[model samples]
Target chain A: MLELIVISTLNGVLFGMLLFLLSSGLTVIFSMMGVLNFAHASFYMLGAFFGFQLTKWIGFWPALVLAPLLVGAIGMAVERYGLRNTHKHGHVAELLLTFGLAFAIEEIVSMIWGKSPLDYRVPALLDFPAFTIFSTNYPAYKIFMLAISVVIFVALLLVLKRTRVGLIVQAALTHPHMVGHLGHNVGRVFMVVFGVGSALAGLAGVIAGPALVTQSDMAASLGPILFVVIVFGGLGSLPGAFIASLVIGLVQTFAVALDGSLASAFGPLDPSTGPSVLTDIWNVTIAQVAPIVPYMLLVLILIVRPMGLMGTRES
Target chain B: MRKLTLAIAVIAPMLGHAASAEDTIKIGYIDPLSGGGASVGEGGLKTFQYLADELNAKGGILGHKIEIVPLDNKTNPQESLVQAQKAIDAGVHYITQGNGSSVGAALSDFVTKNNTRNPGKEVLYFNYAAVDPSLTNEKCSYWHFRWDASSDIKMEALTNYMKDTASIKKVYLINQDYSFGQSVRTDARKMLGAKRPDIQIVGDELHPLLKVTDFSPYIAKIKASGADSVVTGNWGQDFALLLKAAADAGLKVNWYTYYAGGAGGPTAIKQTGLDQQVFQITEGFANSGNKAAMDYEKAFRAKVNLSLWYPRAVNEMRMFKAAAEKANSIDPVKVAAALEDLKFEVLDGGTGIMRKDDHQFLQPIYISSFGKLTESEPFDEESTGWGWHLVSRIDTPQAMVSTTCKMTRP
Candidate 1:
């Protein structure tokens, strides 16, 4: 029991760190622009695919830097040429634009990647087991994922707190009109934030490609969960995204790890009696509900605390 | 007078066709031609086209030229229904589909309903690869004929092999949380329990269908369970991602799967370097040691630029042709009637019977694994150089399990 708990906690933390990497960017973009980037996960997917392509030529290390940069630049172009045009149309239009862009990007990805998973493998350097807990070997790639996520988190904080660009961006986020009145070029700041946010997502994708199989529908698959993380973490709050990511990740991982059955809990409840809702409920085990835990939390959070765990506003 | 003219306009085409009956027999090939299932669906389309060409070269089926009408469903059930309706509107009475069982179930139900409502315009749904089991069992229809082995049939063959393999003692069950996945889990547990009562069931886990991005947490549970083997019915990315996670975690366990050779599966398997540890049960694989099958695959690869993932597509096509010839008619009703209890030579040198009970095809099912190519092996998946070698061959007698199909014939 102790070993299972230890392993499950570690695995949860590792998974949470990756989720933070994905949701942090989303939260930042949301906080600054107040336009939820539905294509954020799609950009992450593009990062992985681009990283795979770049790795084919220059290898993994260079691809890690280059792929995210490419994705960030693409995100910036979309913001400048695409989203900017639709900005006057209201939040609904922007959301719809990003949603449509997500589908379009997925289609383009399918066209190029052939609707099959790329053999985007983890680097041989990080392929070995980091350590084994009670005979369960944790892969070094996962550890690297955790370390990179932490580094990004720390770097993001330091840059935002101590840098002049950070203060300008922060001020612009709160009062874009005022920042522009003070001659801070708020548009450029928004564009840069969008780029950096997208870059963060891309970096997450680059590292996550091998860990999670990089397929065409990858964006669609992980995109919803990333939204859940941000929403649950309190939309637009980086710290909230961090906490929510861990909460969801840990909830899901620990849920799967749990072997509790309703039958066991209720003392030999037979389900063969047929056609009863209670019977149906009794038949379900914790493992079966693990995937829905995040969404369930989202629902509970919205119902109880609309502002979210650390959120200032109801989004 | 206007109503008469409208009726005449609708009747004009039928009258024109009656005067000079169509020369070509159209088979509406409904499958995912785009989106996630595109690779597999496109491959099926190519095979069907190839088979049409092959049939046409030999004077077509019953003196009519074979025309394959390809429709893209985008792997959605509602879209498949729309495509099916369009195919029916195009005067097609023969349609085939595969890929997703959910889509298959929808198409089958739709075809059955359509056939019941419109007698002469009834379409025969020849399923090439959707193997949900219930489609043939409780939900069986006379209008539907499944050419591929159902999930339960495949699982039976798989568990039968596991029962004999002494290395498999502690087994785990992990499947996508859906109707098909549920069926796989239920059948596996029942079959394994019956086969090897001594084998301990370590863990049974069901995650959301196709929604799992990472399988590490599931793998962690599997590791904790101390399972020596895994039985899963995950296809597409689910299957590939599961194996990738297992490989990354360095989990040394035998995998008995239904679709470990799906698109991108070979890449994952190769990355893992599992060699012969992973096993898959299918009607036929890329290299099953038959010269004719090998030649067919070579021509198919050269033409389609994809490994023949679905050998049953060839089987289904060939059987359709044979049934048409036997019936001496291109009418779907006549062909479907002729297809019942029909036995024909399969691609890999074996006879397959279209069982009258459930309209299910029973053929020699091969259990294969990725390993070093033997002298007889001809092709590999995704140019991996590591072809799937035949591990065990379950003959028709063993694979032909009883079904609960009470199909009402028209």
Candidate 2:
């Protein structure tokens, strides 16, 4: 029991931290620009692919630095040409354009990389086991991931909170006219903010690609849960994103550790009875439905706290 | 619609006559041609197309030029039915599918109902890889033929092997929560209990199929349970991610799997450095030391840039040609009759029988490990530098199980 608790908590926090890393960029874009970048996940995919390609050419360490820059540049270009063109048509048009861009990026990646998983791996330097907890030797690479996430979170908070560029970006969000009147180049501010957000997503992809399967469809898999994290975190709140990522991660982890089902309360259901909704619900162990727990949390949080666990906006 | 049917009936003979002159024997390749399962589906398409070309190069299948009609079902059973309809509309007499058993079962039923309703235009379903045992048991159809060993048969063989190995004292079961995975777990439990009663089952987990991106939590549970071995039916990404999580946690345990040799599987095992620890039970693998199979695998990989995922697909296609030649007809009814109890030489140099009882192909199943290749093991998977080393081979008799299928033949 002690082992289960210790290990589950560790795994949960690690997973949660990874989730925050993935969602931070999406959260920033959603809040700063008030334009939900639907292609954010695509940029994340591009980050991973670029990381893999750059890693092959240079090294993982160098690729880690270059991949996000490359992805951010791509994001900046997309913002300039793709999103900007659609911006005048309203927010829906921009969203739809990003949506189409996501598909286009996926296709391009598929054409280039093919539909198979690339052999992205952790560097040999950080391959050894970091520590042992109840006989489970946690890899040093995971610890490295945790440290990176923490560093990014702290750095992002510091920059957004205490910096001139950050001040101007924040001012431009709500008072674009005034910022423009003050000669701040509101368009360029939005463009830079968008690029930084895309860069953050790319950084995440670089870290995550080696840990997770780096494939063309990597974004499609992680895209939905990212939205869940941001929404549950209170849609534009960084701290809310952090807390929500941890909560959802821990909940999912602990849920999978639990074997308990309603069967203990209501007798064992017969398999011969065949598949039905009642039997499925009654017989399903917590561990079996672990994936759905986050969505359930999303629904519950939406109902109880419509704005989110921490958010300024009600919607 | 009636007039259309009557018009088709009148024109069909002329179409058939014209077809006899230059008409190709079209086998509709229906599976996920696009979307998440596209990689697998595309590989299947290539293998079938390769087999068709191989047969065509050798005077074709009874002088009828072979052609594979690729239909994208997108891994949806409903869409598979739509594709099946399209295939039939285009005069395709046979179709093969294998990615998901749900799609396979759906196609089987559709073929059976269609065959019953439209007697002259019967479609035969050649199942190459969907291993859900239910497809061969109560759900078996006369119009359907399975070329792969069912999940239960595999579990039976796997547990039989485990029964002799005393090192595996505690076992954990993890599989995707679906018909195929459910059957794998159920069969593993039953077979292990019956075969090796001393072995304790520490944990059994069924997660959503292909939904889990992270498996660290599950690894924690397995760690807590202190299981020395895990039996899983997880394939593709599920299998890959599980190995990834296990590697991260440094959980050292034997992975007894159904598809540890799938696409990206060998790479995962190699990356995790779990050399010779990941065991897979399958019909055949790339490096089975069978000279013919090795040669074929080399040529196949060279031409298609894909591993021969399904030796069963080869058997399915080869046997299709053999049966048609024997029947001396391209008619589905005749071909189905010839296929029943047709014992043919497997691609891996063994005899596999397409049993008339349930149309389940009973062949020698191999349990192999993905690890460092020896000098003898020439073929390595996905350029992983580690090949499948043959551990044991369970002959057809030992791997065979009774089927409750009572076929209603036309």
Best by TM-score: 2
- CA shift of B269, model 1, Å: 0.9
> Which lDDT tens digits does candidate 2 get at residues A30-99?
8898888888898999999999999899999999999999999988888888777887898999888889
Task: Please report, in order, the local distance difference test score of every candidate based on alpha carbons.
Answer: 0.87, 0.90
Model 1 misses residue A243 by how many Å? 1.2
* DockQ of model 1 vs. true complex: 0.70
Summing lDDT over every window of 10 consecutive residues in candidate 1 chain B, give the lowest-scoring window: B16-25
**Two-chain DockQ for each candidate model:** 0.70, 0.82
Tens digit of per-residue lDDT, candidate 1, span A1-315: 787788778878988998998888888899878989999999999999999999999999999999999999999999998888898899999999999999999989988877777888889888888987777778888889899988888888788888998899889877889999999888888888999999988998898998887888788778889989988988887788889888888889888877687876877565467758787677688878888889999999999999889999986
Q: After superposing candidate 1, which stretches have Cα over 4 Å from the reference?
A: A270-272, A275-277, B1-21
* TM-scores for the candidates: 0.94, 0.96
Question: Measured by C-alpha RMSD in angstroms, how accurate is candidate 2?
Answer: 5.0
Residues B16-88 of candidate 1 have per-residue lDDT tens digits of 7664457788899999887667777887888888888988899887777788999999989999999999999
Residue B246's lDDT within candidate 2 is: 95
lDDT by residue for model 2 (B1-410), tens: 99999999999999887877556889999988767888888888999999999998998887898889999999999999999999999989999999999999899999999999997888899999888888988998989999989999999889889999989999999999999999998998998999889999999999998889889999988888889999999998999999999988889999999988877788899899999999999988988989999999999989998889889888888899899989999888999999999999898877889899999999998999889989988888888888899999888888899999988878
How far does residue B96 in candidate 1 sit from its true spot (Å)?
A: 0.8
lDDT of 1 at A175: 85
